[model samples]
Target chain A: MENTALEKSVLNKRKTKSLILRFMVWLCGILTVGILAYILLFILVRGIPNINMEFLFGEYNSDSLSAFSSIVTTVEMIVISLIIAVPVGVFCAIYLHEYAKRGNKAVKVIRLAVDTLAGIPSIVYGLFGMIFFVNILGLRASVLSGVLTISIMILPVIISSSEEAIKSVPDMYREGSLGLGATRLRTVFSIVLPTAMPGILSGVILAIGRIVGETAALIFTSGTNVLENPTLDLMASQRTLAIHMYMLASEGLPYSKDMAFATGAILIIIVFIVNFAATKLAGRIGGLSNGK
Target chain B: MESIKKSKFNDTVMQSVFFMSAFVSVLAVIAISLFLFLRGIPAIAEIGFMDFVFSEKWGPVNTPASYGILSMIVGSIYVTAGAIVIGVPVGLMCAVFLAEFCPEGIYKIVKPAVNLLAGIPSIIYGFFGMQIVVPFVRDNVGGNGYSILSASIILGIMILPTIISISESSIRAVPESYKEGSFGLGATKEETIFKVVVPAAKSGVLTAIILGIGRAVGETMAVVMVAGNAVMPLDKIALLKPIRTLTTNIVTEMSYASGLHESSLIATGVVLFVFIVILNASLSLIKFRSSRN
Candidate 1:
């Protein structure tokens, strides 16, 4: 009887609760992937067929320019914001990761500051952009305002990611460069930066994705009117694709609904391509670093 | 000798360059705080604190227009709470699966899918919610499709990436020794995970939830699209009812608003700023405590 009881307990060791738990986990995992697939396929199915050159580049009235200009504005925002943000962010990372002494109070404060900056909601950034850039600084609801605002919004992200990249440059590389009579500055610029370029580029890609997709912060700062004739005037208000999508949808104009979907589809495609590349690059970095 | 001198000079110049660059972040934060206060406070003062925050009459276009944001505040809270309810369980489950249950081949696909979710822009999510969830709500649940329910569903989906990624990392950070010990003690795998492993990662999971709330609360474009954005009484609750959040309030009205109305919107931003700051402080405190432990 005792032997039979032991066998029965052993047979029942894979409990029903465990089975249920396993099922739930799988259900959730599949559910998450399902939701993602649904969103992508749904949007693409509706958005892709609508996308045409006319939809993309043509103006509402033939007299004015079209969704094409929003694309232009997005590019301008990306370029201008990155130009301002990248160097400063990289240098700040350098100071934190390399120059600052370990366990220092100042470094700790700065580290906390970056985290705080990261947590602050993007809408708050919008208000700051409006008050400081658009009003006080007289940027006047232009591309310049959007650039300045987005630069700040992306700063903490760039700093944190770039710091991680810089940190991954093994101490031996830095020591070897310095031991070869290279100045500290020379070691960072010539050796460390080059080796860390892939990682930094991946961070920049992420930042670009963010800049392209952002709408709310840019709404007040950039202002949502697409320029009639695209020019190099950073002072002129222009729409981004995301803002265009928002405006078109919110207005509930029957004619513009398909255009909004097409724009969303285009936006999704761009973001997807960039994201896929970043993951591949990150994977490569992992392999390279592991090999080293 | 000349080269050595030049190298020393380069170090000084680059060092200062780094200093100034780092200072830019600090200066920017200070400027944001300064400007928000400088612009936002006077508007609140002019409106009166009780009147600004307590009254629900937000019709700035009406005769003797009012600027109270109580309804918007309630709308934000309701939407955020609903998101937390909808998002946290699914996200936490997905995190646990990824951290422990996922097979290698499945892991690769699952991981990228989560990243893709994160990468998809907010506006697209807004569009998706507007197209799908909004209509579903309107049809099935009654009332206009653009309700708190619609915003909640979208925000819920949007916060999944944040919650899953952070919670997964925290679960992974749990020491292998603890799990092994649980196994040796004859705990079932589910028992070990639920009773031991998940508890060990409790603070981290809490951090994830908090961060998710922050994301949901701050979200503007998506919420504006789905939430009906009506200024209504807070005492009566309806899932299918239209309501305005603080974000949509500012975004919707700012374009047409002028004079005191504009300032009131900036003041609305000030209230949001305070909410976010409090959330950040709590999140960091949690992190600090967890690190100490």
Candidate 2:
């Protein structure tokens, strides 16, 4: 009878401990999710009521230039930065994965440099942009300057991500192609790249998200002029959504406060879509490859 | 012969372009560092390096335009230290909970939520802090709306995702055998986790803390929004008083600044750059040592 009572108490204690552990995990998860949901929900609640089609696709009012011009500039800057960054990032990834040996000193140096760049603060990047691109290159707060600055900002992210993707392509495929008498270049381009395409696309999308959200580097390099839309003239000064929102709050423009919230909502939505799509694509590709 | 020539031609060009791209990417970092150092040297020499660092007055507009950055340096340390004190323990505990105790479904939901936090823009964080944290601190902490405490709270929140993610990965990497061994010895799950698993993952946890410090120190927009922009020092425990950090000082003053004022702000950039370099180097070293072990 005593032995039975002891067993019962021990079992009860075990059950209680499990419950306590579960509760702690749930609490941690809830806190993280709660903070994110609060941020998103607050912006949507405050901003969505104010958004309209005109806000999405309208020209700037001179009185409140930040709202309209910033959207246009962000898109133009993304396009230009991608043009420069994507090619360079992909090429560097290709060299690191395909050409460079593991122990090569130059490869090691490149890796270190990329890692350091990834760790460097955005503000320092802003200073560099101000000195090199804006002042010395004399681009001077133009859309072109913003493009150059952000391209560098996203370079490390793209290269590292793309390299990981490329590296994940199975060695069996490479060896099989070579055994079948295909040239190394042909094998990499046709077999490996297609296999790695989904991962690379995900990396590019992530870079897009970073570029759209960036503000600090843009503030110094891209002077806060709200041009209506991008033109062929790269020298035209422009404002991004983030920079516009910052100006609204910091400069204390009462009229444009709602507009800033509206833009913030839009930016968040855009990032969410990109992140969701990239994750889905990568997951699908991963499943298919593993199944094969 | 023609086909062979075409194949060789393409290979050579592709290889050269790929190699050059990698080389250029590396060169970009070296070139930027050299440029910043060179451009900043004249000003540092003019101010005397010690004065440039230790001076308290930062009026870059007056006749003399005092360029002391001591207050800004103190402000940076205060906010960052405050953030570390709050963020590190919560993040580490959360990471431990996720890795050792959570169910699979909960893990999936929680991990992505952390990722989402990381994905949110700094500007959005700034706006959130302005609307929420500023009010909370003013009412509860007995301060005005904008304060260093407010900035620190916001920054702490922003850095939580980074700390949690890195630490969780490290904790997960702790060998399962260690936990199993403790369990066999009649240790409770909590005891095993605290004694064995955490000790094994100590280096990784250290690395996460370092990364968190880096994030808190480098953060600009959110800190600037809530830090009250007051250029003067406050009295004892001045949560309500405005403070300026190095990053904020540069951002706030760089617009209308010219000549010596501009140079001094650039000097702040130099100082910030050096601090980041040291932080990153240490982080990398920790990461290297941990991975090797």
Interface RMSD for all numbered candidates:
1.0, 2.0
For lDDT, the strongest prediction is 1
User: Model 2, DockQ value?
Assistant: 0.56
In order of appearance, the predictions have TM-scores of 0.96, 0.94
lDDT of 1 at A164: 77
Candidate 1 lDDT, tens digit per residue, A91-139?
9988888788889787777777777778777788888999899998888
For model 1, state the Cα shift of residue B273 in Å.
1.0
True contacts kept of 1: 0.76
Question: How many clashes would you count in candidate 2?
Answer: 1
Using DockQ as the measure, the top candidate is 1
lDDT of 1 by residue, B1-293 (tens): 99899889989988889877877877877888889888889999998999899988788888888888998998999999999999999999999999999999999999999999999989999989988999998889888898989999999999999999999999999999999999999889988998899899999899999999989999999998888777888775578888899989999888998988998998998898889889988988897898897
Per-residue C-alpha lDDT of model 2 across residues A1-292, encoded as one tens digit per residue: 9999999899789768856765765676677778889999999899888788667767777454436567777888888899999889988998999988889998988888888788777887888888899999888888898899889889998898789788888888889998997776778799888888888888888888988889888888987776665454679877788888887767666667787788789888988888887787667557646738
